[model samples]
Target: MTTTASNSLQNIVIYTNNKISLDFYKPFEDGLNPILFTVKTLEQIPRKTENKIHIVILESCDELSNLQINCNKIHLIMPAFLKNKLENDLHALIFKYEQSMNSQQALENLYHSFIKFYCSAEYYLDPQDFFNSDSYKDGYRCINIHEILQDNVSYEQQLHTYLNTISNTETVSFNFSIGYEFSSESGYLQLIENTVDHLTYAKDRDVFFSVVLSKHPLSDNRLAIVHLSQ
Candidate 1:
């Protein structure tokens, strides 16, 4: 989605991949340039200017700490599968707030908790939870992107069923942290197309990447893409 910022100018810098739709940004495009970048590598991204309030939207938290950019506000776009945990947390908090005697007082604390846990950080996600193995071993190895996708390949069976209900063919990205016990092999996967330049990855492994393919809303036969947790 969308992030609210306190800027008269409403300046923004959006990072995207093919899967997410930028149509949601049409209204703000005229007032400000809203610097945008297609996520592939950090080097290609334009450098951030100083003392400016801009919204930065990124696909994964993998490069969040690595990137040396400053912005007034940031939005971490996430995949559909990953939203469950955060939503569950919110629902749980709302329930807790409803039950508490000091509901009004607790609401303020809840707001701060939300901001601090998910929003206030330099980046919204932690890399260790997603890619790093916090085991006894000190060294790590890069897992092939193909292997990552293949491990979750069973989702291919229902790929067509999901694509058939594509009322919106715009980019909707997502972000989530994978725990130390996290294993890609356990998740439900729906693969579309998996063709990247190289299969070997290190920093990128921290990113759980996949794509969803469907027909364009207007165009015929042409495919629309959605990157999972990109």
Candidate 2:
């Protein structure tokens, strides 16, 4: 179960307390195969599995505290509404882009979409409080790639060190936005490709990454998101 591409085939195991209907998991099946498992609590989820584990928690966020699940691949569905909201927001943004055919508007939507999705992982802290905390600095959360790059560091080592600093967290989400101050579309695409080549070096870790291309300009022309679980 690799997170290299969105359409890549993956075997998923869904763990839930029957809070969500089977229909909700159907969309993921479009490109991946999923096997459903209903568990009364997180403890019931297997510590070892060949399939990707997705823990869907509809009720208490406290279940995540002091957690100890050992798996190569794991994800969390905290609050239970995140998937539906993401789908809806993306749909709305598509409609808006189609109606206006405004490229800038599309770029803005692209940036907001990733940010919103990253912020939706509210299992540890409320979005507002999380943003206000020292962990969230200059739009980067958990690990700051920019700081790591300044010292000519290894991203994998830096990522591991940062993940170790986070206490009681089994999963971490990363969101990055990259833009070009002035470059051709081909140039931007090349930059994106190169950036991905550099970041996806840690193949042994269970990390999910998403990259969106847009014409929006940023001071540094780069944005990134990395979600990981162990």
Candidate 3:
């Protein structure tokens, strides 16, 4: 594979401290020449002053907040759905994204951190293929659920709890909408106050995920696609 093989303008930066994982990224390096590196693997990262869209992937969830790096790296925690997908397919999709630079990870949606990761990977999956597999015979599930959340912290927390319970899963994602009326975080969360307990058990067999939010006294709807494998 060659960098010119796919004409994309995206700059992907992948960092990790694990050695065995380098082979997993060699394809990306040869295909896109992405800024792939581990702590001691590379001499140094690209200059912070470079004008480029940086997408960082962490192989391990090591807390990088304290690390002093010049580049304002946008670390996109890989979505659960992507961790186990066809490696070759994922590589090709990412290259296309670079060339187009068009995605659903907008600020208004606020999905850049997590959703971009999802879009760059799972968004390419055929929806028809996903809904048809009702059983976890393959040990994974592509969950698409829409729900309301009463609090930001609670919503994100419960989302993480499910991920933690899944097989080697660490990343979870969802969209949360707020009515134009709710001027405060507490108030926005209150909209889903009544459904908190039920949402905690979203994996139950009887729970049917919705593509649309339940219209009630709220104007904002939250969309969440939590890919968890119990």
Candidate 4:
């Protein structure tokens, strides 16, 4: 199918408890249109529609748990802490079926040294604008999740491109460092250990694949390495 024809068949439906102002998602309305719906109403929509639905859950509701198991179809957008907790709690059993193939290779590559930093609420709340700004891209290049969501492709395809970039890096050992005031190297190292453990198990999960550094907690000309892959 042509790119335009394929894009017309896909759209993002974000399910949330309360009705969020459409204005928040206004900028992303092009290409893959974004629509908001509550869990109750989401069920009411026809299941056999022409458009391929990409579900994004804003807040967890009990009714959505069954659908949540299919990570490809349903995406949960909770706080960074909550997502981390879920990754720690359920990652092992969730993808146990593929352990034999992925675990060993993933283990040997542990020394690659990667880190996924959680963006501050300020950045995530208006990710479109923050990602578009030159300030965040001053030190290094990044893949903007907001912009990718606006594209005519699936998140998985975009993720594949990102993983390929990591694999193609010239050096294996990468480090993520923040300014001294916000955290010490030891504290940051501990956080990285915990995050990598969860990440190692559920590497393909999109929620666990962020590299954006927090913009708040330090508002100066200080430079922080959000991600380092060489």
**Which window of ten consecutive residues has the lowest lDDT sum in model 1?**
87-96
Global fold similarity of model 3 (TM-score): 0.26
State TM-scores per candidate. 0.21, 0.30, 0.26, 0.27
What 10-residue stretch in candidate 3 is worst by lDDT?
88-97
Best by lDDT: 2
On TM-score, the leading prediction is 2
Looking at candidate 4, what is the lDDT of residue 124?
A: 19
Which residue pairs in candidate 4 have backbone atoms (N, alpha carbon, C) closer than 3 angstroms, thus clashing?
171-230
Writing each residue's lDDT as its tens digit, candidate 2 over 1-230 gives: 22322322333344544443333333321122223334445566665544332433333334545344554223333332222222111101111223332333333333243322322221111222222222222322222122233113364465455555533332233443333334465764564454445442342333334333324445433334333212
Count clashing residue pairs in model 1: 7
Write the residue-wise lDDT of candidate 3 on 144-215 in tens digits: 323335445575566545444544331233333333444665653554343334344433332222121222
- In candidate 2, position 173 carries an lDDT of 38
lDDT of 1 at 164: 35
Q: Report the number of clashing residue pairs per model.
A: 7, 13, 5, 1
* Candidate 1 RMSD to the real structure: 20.4
- Better by TM-score, candidate 4 or 3: 4
